[model samples]
Target: MSDQLQNLDLPYFAIFLTFFLAVLSSLLVLAPTQRGISATWDYLKQVKFIERNGIVVSTYIVIAVSLWVVVMIVAPQFFMVELSFHDGTVAADVNYDYSQTPYTFNNYSYVIFGSGSDDSYFNVLHLKVFLRTIIASVCITLLAFVLCYPIAYYMAQTAKGGTVRLLLICLVLPFWVNEILRAFAFRILFGSSGVINSVLIGSGIMDEPFDFIKADIAMYAGLSYAYILLMIFPIYNAIESLDHNQIEAARDLGSSWSRIHYRVVMPYAKPGIASGCTMVFMLTAGALAAPQILGGPSSLWFTQIITNWFNLGDWTRGSAYAFLFLLSCIVFVLTVMKYFKVNLGELAK
Candidate 1:
């Protein structure tokens, strides 16, 4: 048995086995409850709980607090931090070492303030990437919302099942193909000397093919295509749940189409807009592949900073970048929540 266990290849097998055994032992201890012997004791315990809902809730709180204590006190010290060396000479291997660690803010200072002769703590390239990420995310979200809003409204207002189903199928059909393949297909279409240019030039629209690759226009177009469905589905569901009677009542009171939409429909669709914007923002901010392939060397985004850090074996700096990105996202979310006057609980509803 020991030899067999030693030969086991599964990394988490021991942990799973321990949990299984603990559960099995618990079941065994509770087995007497299945018989009449422990029935009276169980009933007594249940009756004692009637006067102590507060006590039950308090017990849960205490257990949760204890679990957190264990995690905070025991986990961090035991877990080792892995480091990698990649000087571009040999195969980089992870090493666990903290022997010469200093009890100061040296690492943070070095990352933030830079080393001698470098003269800067933060990388300017990274700053550029971060700004580009924000710009790209905002552009994608706005473009997607503009393109999807009308389609979603139409889908919601339409009553015919066949038409709605067909529209939905058309909306989602692109997803049937793999995302990378779709991106590459866009790349092909929008590349210099591609179909659009060929047709335009052949029709005497221009003398030369337009340079579509690595342009901001191409990046926005590609990202908008990728994320339009995300924006559409949420807004469609939100608008579908709206009461049509309200719109009819507004119309009866002589409200114009624009007035009805602005006053009645827009407020209800806020939650969906919030959700879709959040999704698009996060996805586009962290996007690496699309920018790399379509936008090429000219376009830089924050995720590329993460990639550079990882490739250079700078885990601490990479973690810092991730946390900074998270902080920015949280701030944006909070701002939106405040502006909309909607809490997370309301949005969830």
Candidate 2:
């Protein structure tokens, strides 16, 4: 086979060809009457083995435990250790030594405390950026949930298919535009000479144009707009799958609207809410573009710090920060899974 075909990794194709030939050969070897006898004999042999179940059960348990150990514990630690060894290296000619030394906790210490050298190290500003990112992510996730839940619930309960379809289309329409273009559009709208200010000034709504770009309000609005659809779809799917009869039954039993929602609808929709929150939190936490454009100079987010470290040839600190963010995402996902009592693996499907 050509290199290009080999690179396609057609192992499954090869397996299918082999299996087809084996089946054809088996059919040729066995006469039509003997096929039934062979099948019955094979079944009897398998049933006889099943009668001796202890060894089979023990072997299955051992295989499952071994797979779990490799997947859950050993694999991640192995990769983290491998990445740590080659974390930081300078490409261009510089006075700094780029020695591949033995692995040590120096990278962790530098990430926690300022290194006070050419090597990029964690600082108070970095910490502030990290904290601000957490705060921003939490705010965005909460606000998205608040806004999305009502719309999702309305769409789920209402029978107006045309209106629901229109709303869903409109919600997803912004995503068709390029993300950077959308961010720039927001930037223009919130900029000093943008349309919002011009209209407000023209209408005498305020004396001066609001400084939205330098403020947190602009960041919140932009990020929320970016991730709103992600928050909506999961909740919508969740609520759609719910049994509306149970909800009507609750109301028939003299339950108030609030009681019906809290008691009947919310529990069923917990999986969707958890899934949506996980997505929104993770996306907002790692947001780079919206903050960079809308936040101006004052609101430097965690991603910008990573960018700076990368620019300064400080891969170690950058990797450390990246890993930390990854850990946070994992923890947040696990927490959501725990709260909803849903297996993340199953929900992800």
* Candidate number achieving the greatest lDDT relative to the actual structure: 2
Query: How do the residues 1-349 of candidate 1 rate in per-residue lDDT, one tens digit apiece?
Result: 5754564445444443453344344323323333343674477467764356567785786578557644763333122111111111233346523222222233334334545356565655556667768876887888888888889988997557799999999888988987777778878888777888789898999898788875556666787888778888888989999988988999999999999888998788988877777777778777777776678657776777767776776554554565457557656765777787855544443
Score every model by TM-score. 0.69, 0.70
Tell me the spans in candidate 1 whose CA falls farther than 4 Å from its real position: 1-122
Candidate 1, poorest ten consecutive residues by summed lDDT: 80-89
Which RMSD does model 2 reach against the true structure? 14.4
Candidate 1 differs from the real structure by a C-alpha RMSD in angstroms, to one decimal, of 12.2
Q: Count the backbone clashes (under 3 Å) in each candidate.
A: 3, 0
- The C-alpha local distance difference test score for the whole of candidate 1 amounts to 0.65
Error of 2 at 104 (Å): 3.3
Off by over 4 Å in 2: 1-81, 85-101, 116-122, 336-342
Q: State the C-alpha lDDT per candidate.
A: 0.65, 0.70
